[model samples]
Target: TELQEIAPKEFEGRIKRQGVVNALDDEDFAAAVRETGRKKLIIAGVTNDVCTVYPTLTALQLGYDVQVVADAGGSPTKMADDIAIRRMENAGATITSTVQLLAELAENWTSERGGKIIPFVMGLMPQQ
Candidate 1:
């Protein structure tokens, strides 16, 4: 596929996680990432104080260089966001932007970064 040629190395896979507080297990999550042959994880979700933070924390504890993209994450209120960020920090989670993830994964302009990503960045920047 066209996109595959753009970033053949940075493939991602999805997994299903099911459990309650203090009951959720991360081995399966780790397995999914392993299945993709990646050592680092980037994730985001709602209710950042719980659903988002818990698993990411678990990932860090498991030794994955975890970065939670903040723009792709959100909470119901400012209080929730505050608590979520604090909890994630306590758990050793690094917060990063979506753009940062793109550049890291892209690695260089030889591929998609310059070819297919220009329009996307154009949208993020203020018009001249």
Candidate 2:
């Protein structure tokens, strides 16, 4: 309910599931991903070490391209975050920032999709 409230209307109908620390371990979550027929997955979680890393590694093994949004996930400490990020990188998950991910997705700033995304991303920047 909270997610539906916060998510954009278009994504409110997307499949969502509460699962174990490793999302791939949950049958429904894994199934939903497979149903999408997508090879690439962009993921963020409450914590990088436990919540993000586990599923990222598993997803890589399952032959999906996984990108972890570094700033979107947290860890108990900087050391923990660093190690988790390194671990995921070593296992072949691309570690990206929210802005970088958006740019990659949008591709061209003059495009209609880019025009929409650029404003949203710019809003996320810190004021000078």
Candidate 3:
């Protein structure tokens, strides 16, 4: 419900939606990931501790590679956020900034797709 509500209209027909009542117990999530036939995941959620951490831990347990976007995940406090990030890292999930995530996805600055990606990614930079 929340996923559908929050997803942009442009992605309506294209994106798959799954509900996790408690991420730790969400079998559907694992099923969906397996359905993709991809082992790597880039994850972010509304709350860093419970929302993000639970799913990440589960993914690790299921043998999928995981990366969490620190800036995109939120927590009740900075301390909580730090703790969650450390926990994920200790559990073997790579913690990354959104910029790094985008850059990795774009792969190269000189490529044709990078021409589009680089500008959008650069727009996210902080002004000097």
Candidate 2, residues 56-109: lDDT per residue as tens digits?
A: 999999999999999998999999999999999999999999999999989999
Compare candidates 2 and 3 on TM-score and give the better one: 2
What is candidate 2's CA lDDT for residue 118? 98
Model 1 over residues 36-109: C-alpha lDDT tens digits? 77777776875676667877887787787878887677888889888888888777888877777667666775
lDDT of each: 0.70, 0.90, 0.82
- Over the full model, what C-alpha lDDT does candidate 3 score relative to the true structure? 0.82
Cα TM-score per model? 0.66, 0.89, 0.80
Worst 10 residues of 2 by lDDT: 10-19
Ranking by TM-score: 2, 3, 1
> Which wins on TM-score, candidate 1 or candidate 2?
2
Candidate with the greatest TM-score versus the true structure: 2
Q: Clashes in model 3: which pairs?
A: none
- Against the true structure, candidate 1 reaches a TM-score of 0.66
| Worst ten in a row by lDDT for model 1 | 15-24
Candidate 3 lDDT over 1-128, as tens digits, reads 65567675734654334676346475555566678898898888888887889889988988989999988878999999999999999999999988898889889888887777898688899889
- Please say which candidate is ahead in lDDT: 2 or 3: 2
Model 2 whole-model lDDT (C-alpha atoms): 0.90
